[model samples]
Target chain A: MSEVREPQSDERLQMPSDPYSVPLDKIDVAQPHLFANGDHWKYFERLRSEAPVHYCEDGFEGPYWSVTKYDDICHVDSSHNLFSSEPAIVLADPEEDFELEMFIAMDQPKHDVQRKTASPVVAPQNLKVLESTIRERVCTILDSLPVGESFNWVDRVSIELTTQMLATLFDFPFEDRRKLTRWSDVATTDPEQDQSIVASEEERRAELIECLEYFGKLWHERAGNGGGSDLISMLANGESTKDMVNKPLEYLGNLVLLIVGGNDTTRNSITGGVLALNQNPAEYDKLRANPALIPNMVSEIIRWQTPLAYMRRTANEDTIVGGQTIKAGDKVAMWYISGNRDEDVIERANEFLIDRPKARQHLSFGFGIHRCMGNRLAEMQLRILWEEIVNRFDFVEVVNEPTRIFSSFVHGYAEMQVVLHPKKA
Target chain B: MAKITFIEHNGTKHEVDVDNGTSVMNAAIDNLVPGIDADCGGQCSCATCHVYIDSDWVAKAGSPDDQEESMLDLNPERQPNSRLSCQIPVTDELDGLVVTLPEFQF
Candidate 1:
């Protein structure tokens, strides 16, 4: 695994921060610092106007194409046959020794089958069953927050609510719920990009192994228990996945997928909504005036945050997207973050509008088969949180600038200080 | 013009006059019909526009193509007559076309 790790190039380290100052060919949006500093928007804007289907030959994660336009992203994402999601979905190749098999990074028959087996847990029908439980949890978390003092909303509200929801989904032990949050952070955290979560790749691997062993015990207890609706039981009993327990790595891989899928994405969005509303007070006022806009505001927040920045797909055959000829075996990134802000598709795309029409029609949840399975679940959680919030607090005020996450993959905040103002009776 | 009828999951009916080339999904969305989301617009990518073709109109509305099938197959709530409304183009073959929208888009 150490031998497979590529050393960072000095040129990449010294690359200019300004998008316009650098040559068109020198633009590499994959750099983690750009996103960390909130400087990615200008870079993507330049690429969208000058070179929508831009390519970087010498990136830290090797060469990859950036699909920046909204329609072009749809084309790449929908054409599953032309571009395959194999090996991994991030720009960096998976460690050869620790390669894990998960459905989102797979194509065709296998992807469809495994996804079908696990998706029922978060399906709309099941979400209806989970709604009341989620509201109850949301209320408790909100009620516990200190109203007068400023606190890190990311840790207190965002992380706590999402972590609790994930525990309920897996029917996991309520006491060890924060373990889910740690594993989720470790799963997506690249030590090269951010060492705050884990000191090194070896540490990341060790923590994930610990997570596998923990869930393995649960799998054993539930494998033959006649199939409960919880995710672990479904995977343990489903026809295609029942044998997954025998394959430790495969079992671990699916566990990480479900964990991170349910965790980091929603956690960041929850935090992002508070920050967005604070930044645009008029929109916040709109939300306050009519709490009915909560559902629509949820969609707008997801689009604005775009929790997971982009998904990487390797081209199976030669393809043409946005007038550029992408060769076979090229890495293509469908930049959902950029696409969600595209002016051509989304009118007045830059501004944050809670009442935006056709709010659900955004690329935040990528289109095609690999589209987010937990989208409805995420929306429900946000909807319920905001609904309860409006019923209680006058405002969830962002007291200071947020410290953003240091990864391009997880587009979110690390910490945000916010003070809750109670509604005047 | 083709007259299309969309039935909600609760049995409410909506009838609209659609242009010859417009899709059933667009017709529903254009007329402010409650059920259809059409998240991917007219593209057959997302299965949000899923609808059940009436038994009488099944033959004329036609079966899903390969792309549509790939999307629809992922849906757990899909029924025998399930078709993505985005894939069905409105025409004058039979004016009184009716399709039922699923309770949830999934």
Candidate 2:
């Protein structure tokens, strides 16, 4: 099957400047340019009102249904039997030549078996052991931040902390921890947009292949050593996934899934929280008044940021959602980012209030069986980071507009310049 | 204190004494009960801690509010006695509470 390609010409990302005044027929929320230019909020809001279960006949990634309403998204995401996660979980189809076989893209018994293998990593017992280690590393990263000087928070704080945590989770080589972040970006990035991420599709595959080779060595070593509690060891030792070594593509796919799953959600939320607090100073003040609210504030931040914009599913059979008929084989994209802001489900849906009731009732970690297994781990990381931040920095001042990732899938920052001002004792 | 009996989908029973004011979700998760994932850390989101209240305890378990009801609607297996364990607070008035874990909490 031929996949939809992003427009790469001179007018590649050109979008209507006025989102509010654009004709309803012209709206395509899947356009990466809308997100890249930070112009999607109004467009999605318009879709929520005019067409909640909208269909895009001209989506860049081919025609796919956009489930923008919260209830509709829940219906689509929860009814996995009717809407399959197979083939792929994004608008883009798997490459015909090199299909990645991660469990999140699989359905039923297979998804459950492979998912159970990695579930122990985020088990409550393991988190108890990892908390102090995470807090210590967080404090070290925060203390090293240069006060009274503007720097890229993405690099200085967000990436550094999350990368370190990923390293710990995988027991990866501490010195080359940044590679995890790199592979994550490459996995989701479009080569057409930036050469720095990946110059071409071949290079993307080569880099990922190289990623598999490295992890492959780790898998062998861990398996020989009788396995352990780390994610790689768990996969290698788990009955369902042990033979993944023979299936290199599946191994690579699961590796990519774990890397991206463990990396993006928390890292982006870390940066987004800083930008959010700066954008909504009252919320920051509320946070400052009672550091006890850090835990709840963390959930609100994740809900508000919605790091992963959406997860796609293919309709297995004809179904009605939001009073719209969706036929079998139709590509369905559950817009978690839009659902996070659904006004009816979440009161004051657009605001950044930390004290909002039912703050965690959002679609950021998704819903149903495909719900993020690392959700509590992600929340704990953010909660601890903010706890440390409130005690130390009075403000994480955003100096300029953030450069957001061009992809519609990873709703995150590429560069956000900020300065941390220390609190007066 | 309230004594809560959690029966896994396979019929494994874990009876624990939870302090009044603790949530049934936390009680299960804290005790390492097998069925309740509580992936959201007891948040009303991610309906992973869904349970079926015994008919005897249904009235005492109380009906779900608007938010909890909205979440429960997403669970296909949800029944009239269904309640999100996270939303149910343990209290002395309901000393012997029984919540049967669903086969699928996803």
Candidate 3:
């Protein structure tokens, strides 16, 4: 079996000839082109209705089950005992030579312990302390925007702000903060497809190893000092994680987890919020009328964005979900993006309404024990940014459609050109 | 301001003065109370901030609404006086209020 299935050429990937007439087996949702070309929602909509628990005989990694319905996704996410997260949590299995074993991919006692070690960083007390710093950063970014001049919002705003926050969380060197963004992009981006992100697997590993080496120095310093509260210091000194340094790979795994955890979700959501607001001008007008809606609007943006589309789980035992029997060792991807758009669970699911009731009830942050720990932090970042945006900017006009990321897992934008208009003082 | 006491399952107590409109979950979060995870940040979505209202304060904290009731139903340790702390808004009437945290909150 092939390890990495290179995507077919674009000519073969045009809109399916009778999307309705296409046989169920011919429908492979793992096609990266569908995501890159921004045509995945229609495919997922068909799948959710036609085959909620459909099994794709040939996925990018291998054959797997696609749990598309909201309830079924919840069933899969909650039944962690039956569907283990170990080995890897994405569609592609970790490379045999350079495996990553983050705690999110672990089960039971280990997952709980390691999660507790990092949870304090996102705890509300800490978030409250970080809020002012976040606002200051947001102000600086907003103020520095090239007024009336078009620029790539993804790099100028999303990546910069998220990278700065990530650096603050790790207490990494401020000048080297962009390295955190690079490592985060490297951790998730497919080196083969996204050459701009990373050219090759060897280069990716070398860059990641560089990340490990840089953090290793901080580990020694933090391990020796009286232990600060940053994530690195916490991991270096926590009762459960203190000895992780001895296991270099595991330590690297956690670093990748924290960096990516702090990076993509917020970054894309920030960019996504701007795009959503631009796409739905009435919602933007409503937001402009009443900034109190920012909190709820932030939740809606996250729901609409649904960054990190699907998380994969390996079946530990044969289980039947929605009349489909997933055999042992089969990978099952809970299509959270589909579930977030499922009309059955969410009222008016496809519409982007800022005032939607139960706005926070989406699968974007995931569910169960493995729910995104940085969820509050992500929401806060969006909430604060919007608050700042409404206070200062008259509008952020989208120049054109965004260049979408070419990955099924990371449902996000690669770049978005925008022109900013500021409110006159 | 209202004074509320959060009691950990292990018998540790933390007292904080909270503004009237603030949530019990926010008060606990503000004071860094150990067990109130509040993972959803007072959205009433996650039940990580589950707390059992002390009998004396149950009348003031009132019952959780339907949305909170459904969320609390997911918690295995939920009790009759149980409320998702994020759903309970602090007020002058709730002064001297006490809520006992479930050990599972951590």
Candidate 4:
């Protein structure tokens, strides 16, 4: 097996200004800087048009085929049998010594068993119970934001709201709610690419172990309590996951999954929606005119953001995708970000239309058994956030270009300065 | 065209005339039915189009195929009569088909 190589951030800076200038075979969209610079779209645009199933042998994370077209991504994602999500779902392999075994990366029977146990917490029925709490939190967060002055929207609103939501889901100590945000960032942060959260792999693992130890205490406390609605309680009381306490790594893996799953994705979408709407003021006008479009706009925002860029799946057997042969054991990346913008699949794919018809038909939540479990929850948060924003603010003006995350896997904003213009009475 | 009756979780019924060969999921979507999301657009990929075939129409609706079964099995609320509406095609064999939308589409 070829070892994954980390492309230095500076190497990506040397990429040509024009994506087409790079030879077809040399185009590697997985470079984290491409995402950080927000220059990945043209590269994916070329791939979707020229080589939809193009392979990058010297990619930062070893060799992987990029599935960029809409239908092709759907085919690869839905065919879980042929394209397994085992070992790891990111382009790079998990460290052998400390592999976190989350259900999202597991195959069949085991995946189904573990996923069912935790899914109920975010299921629509439970979401109804959570709706009011979420709205109350949203209102509080929005109310606290500084008005008419530039502030980091990502920090004040996006991260704060999502962290509070995750804390409520876990019933974690309210005072330490920000710890969920830190752990979520630690879990997904690539030490090689960015050391903002942790200086090295060891530091990352150490922080996650702290996370494990903390959740372990919660698990023990709740395991014998019989029944409760929070995620920790659900896992503790769940038949399949009850014994997870014994498997420390597995227990931590799931906690990381739920945390990162609930946190970063929604956090980015909340920030992204504001940036998107500001970029397209007409859509903001449309939104102000009709707040009824909040639900549909949420889906459109998810599609436009494509928060998580791609999900890696290892081919279980030799299979053909987009007329190209993928050998068994080869890595394949279903670039949801690219597929969401494939013009053939999404009409005016490049444009950010607030009320696009069939807006929910995007690949952001993925497909098949491994599809996003927290999708409805993410949508609900965005919907409620927008509803409250429109009611209170006439405009959430983006004051500057947003600082994007420096990872291809997590396509999101790191910081976006915005000023809230209060709605006129 | 076949007549399809979609009953929401709250017991609201929407009767629509869906053309033959249109999926039950599409019929609900086309008619703007509230409960069925059909997120994957009738691919049987996402189970968002999940519905319960009214007890009377259970046998006629038939058992879900292997792919549909795999998707349906993921739903915690899966019942014996549960089926992904995307997998069910509207046909003349059953004109007055009634399906109840689940409280949530997970």
Candidate 5:
């Protein structure tokens, strides 16, 4: 046993893979490279079918329980007592001691407060007002792309969407939106992999101070004048969103939550959706044919893309799931990437069928109370963008294979070059 | 046209006349009832369109399928009365029925 394990450890240490290296074969809930294999959908199809709640010792994310089945994931999400989102969701925070961090690392009573403060801003009703602007932003960004010319779709469009939308909501200056997006990408999505992030921690910290100062200004303005408006005002002023969470820790946590929430998740979804459509022209054509199906199509795209692939839940007291005993404080990762394609849950799960009758039933936004607050807004953005794409662009095609971001937490592309030409009416 | 009554959680009743094919969720959305949110636009994923059917009408409305039953587990205050409004397509049998909406669907 010693000899066998010794060689494996030696081999791993001897040859390090990519910076954000993830072995696609393992049942890691965090692997972003599952798309590398054509079997991305069914990489764990057999495991999900077999164990449902199997533990993976081979996971780069480490020995966390992989909850792959539909019901189990929902069970873990809802029962916050048993499966806590705090301590850490992705893995142990790479930056062990960073002063600029917040209470996103804390559990209940705390997570509840932060989530509450941030939820309303991204809520469905508020998002409805931003739909037209989101559409206009998508078009304005897309229109800038040259006809039949290749450009990085992820960099140009997806990243920009997240940057601009988040900035608009936060009322950040327009010019600084992209900077905020880049800083957010480095800060939340594993600062370890991006060396540029490591070298520029000081710069990132400085910008963060600037942002905090700006927000501080907003808080004072609201506190004194009381505009009776803006998310910043409500957050700086609103009373407890949850019963036990009226503290200032959550207020700071709310900042981290809002930044990550507003940025990466939607960024990946947009890039993934566009790539999926370009790859499957038939699915794109189906969407083009009805146009009315844009809503359902949006659902399908989210499922297929599975952005923010997996969320980590720390085990509370010792418990059993899928017949496996989980020790207290054990990290259990609910692999939404796998569950989205669970054959038991979705028929022909691997195939990207826009017209799939039950495609809206994906767990990408998650289940239970932790279900994404930004879901409606995400769909609204997707629907309008698709509608506009079909109506405006005569032809859009992937001109080069997309270069994926080297992050285990966010399953997304960093760059995907494409060509677009206006349709001749 | 079919007549429907919505008995809200606050003990308020809303009545709407609808065509034969619209769903209970659709009716609430169409009539702009204060509580009902068809967030998935009448899909079963969001239990936002949840309603509590009258005990006497559970049989008429039948139980939700396995998928919907699973979805409802994620919703709050799950009782025997809970059902996804999208699964219950509007029909003649559902006419003059009363359903109640949960307080927080977000």
Candidate 6:
């Protein structure tokens, strides 16, 4: 990827086609099983070119239509009535549902009201109130890192800040915050599907009962206190209409979503930005030389990494998209992975240009109604994060090819061997 | 300079003089008016700068558009007067506008 390909500028860069015509089974990178193999982008590129609106019928991880075009993604994402986040957001399959419910998964009036319940916490006024607290925590995490020593930046830097932020949001005891982070990551990334984190597949229902009982106590206690310092307190006080009666699982699920949803996704963006910078010395130096550019650089990194790869949506009605008709009840996964590199909207789309005027315009957070609710908070975390990292680290590099998590939905680095050379003490 | 009045949830009114072409949200924040966050840096994304408009100035501010209306679904108490301050441009017509901020936007 380092060697920039040169061609006549007149022609737009496009996905190559011979590969898209291949049978889904025969297609490279089609199986979720191959997610570990890496090089998934090769197949993504093929499909993006030949069948921008192609369906993956023999999908091992998905049989849904993969919508890769930027505009098409916007169309599907913006049309809340046409495509519902309900029926779930991940591309699991025909029959599994998680115990959690989220504003991101609800549509219209319900999604609207549900979003209000948590919006106060994310609203600028609220987040700004927490800025100093967040910065202190960010500094605490950074201050704890061994100076001039190699460490897993992902664990110490990315995860810690976000997890701690979630802890503050839940007002959970700090020592136990990591447990919440783990539960969140596991609940979301478990592609095995329909299995509660608490139980074996054999007694899944029984296990959920136990898990729910334990969590329900906390939910009620928080609600019992009638809301407190954290978001749980806010939701407990905010009115949910007649439709939301006694749904502890849904309420608890929302807590989980807020934690992981805001946690790893932005965490990955930070790690990805450092990895990209460390790999591209010129870009890093470009940033260090112009500290005024940190905010824009953060945007570029999010555009480039697009930490949360794709979110699934089910069609409420049949609609034609990208020259293909999607039947009602069919599943469609909008791969943010492909959309970010889209050639049409972005010139030299594959390349990361730090000064790109439109870096903030990327659909990485998504577009329209269901666009990420935590986007501002995520940016606040990332911007201040990069401000610190760019000032402290003189040099950083990836020592090994990072191993990715197994799930197709989460494109995250499990282990990134990194070496960070500290700034002169 | 233009006059901008901020009505607090408790019914306290703090008025400010603002330059033309500034966002009502920006003017509120610039004047240190109690409750505007402007978190997204005025990207029209974060709904933190929400305010309820005084009906007298509704014509000056006009109605919330689809984008603003949709975002309002995320505000704490939905009122017919709900509008994201960032979306309401501070034009000459809005010179005498009165806006109320929720007790707390968070």
Best by lDDT: 1
Comparing 2 with 3 on TM-score, the higher-scoring candidate is 2
* Residue A124 of model 6, lDDT score: 64
The DockQ values of the predictions, listed in order, are 0.88, 0.12, 0.08, 0.83, 0.14, 0.24
**Ranked by lDDT, top first:** 1, 4, 2, 3, 6, 5
Better of 2 and 3 by DockQ: 2
Candidate 5's residue-wise lDDT over A234-353, tens digit each? 666656532212333334345656677667878888888888888898987887677888777888889988887678788889998878898898888787888888777678888888
For model 6, the local distance difference test gives 0.71
- What TM-score fits each model? 0.98, 0.84, 0.83, 0.97, 0.76, 0.78
lDDT of 2 by residue, A1-425 (tens): 11447663442234575766656765678878778887888888888999888887766677788889988887788676799998999988987788889989998768877887887788656887999999999999999889999999998888898889989999999999999999988888877665247788878888898899999999989985677889999888888888999999899999889889888878899999999999998888998899988877888999989999999999999999999999999999999999999889888999999988657678898877778888878988998999888889888899999998887888999999998889998
* Better DockQ candidate (4, 6): 4
CAPRI tier of model 1: high
lDDT of each: 0.90, 0.85, 0.84, 0.89, 0.68, 0.71
The most accurate candidate by DockQ is: 1
What DockQ number belongs to candidate 6? 0.24
Question: Model 6 off-target regions past 4 Å?
Answer: A1-30, A33-35, A93-99, A191-214, A224-226, A241-245, B1-68, B75-106
Clashing pairs in 5: A394-A423
Chain B only, TM-score of each candidate: 0.97, 0.97, 0.95, 0.97, 0.91, 0.90
iRMSD for every model:
0.6, 8.1, 7.8, 0.8, 6.2, 5.2
Comparing candidate 1 with candidate 2, which one achieves the higher DockQ? 1
Best by TM-score: 1
Query: Across residues A1-425, which tens digit of lDDT does each residue of candidate 6 receive?
Result: 00112332442222234444456434533334335455567677767787888775544444578888777887787677788888578765423433456677777887877776776777666787888988888777776777655678788887888888888877777887777666656555443333224334334334434545655655567775756757767676666722232775576557556766778788788788877876677887888788788877878899888887788889988999988999998888888878888898678878877777647667787765676777778888988877777667776667777766665666676667677667777
Worst 10 residues of 4 chain A by lDDT: A1-10
**Residue range with the least summed lDDT across 10 consecutive positions in model 2 chain A:** A1-10
Over all chains combined, what TM-score does candidate 6 have?
0.78
Lowest summed lDDT window (length 10), candidate 3 chain A: A1-10
lDDT, residue B50, model 3: 89
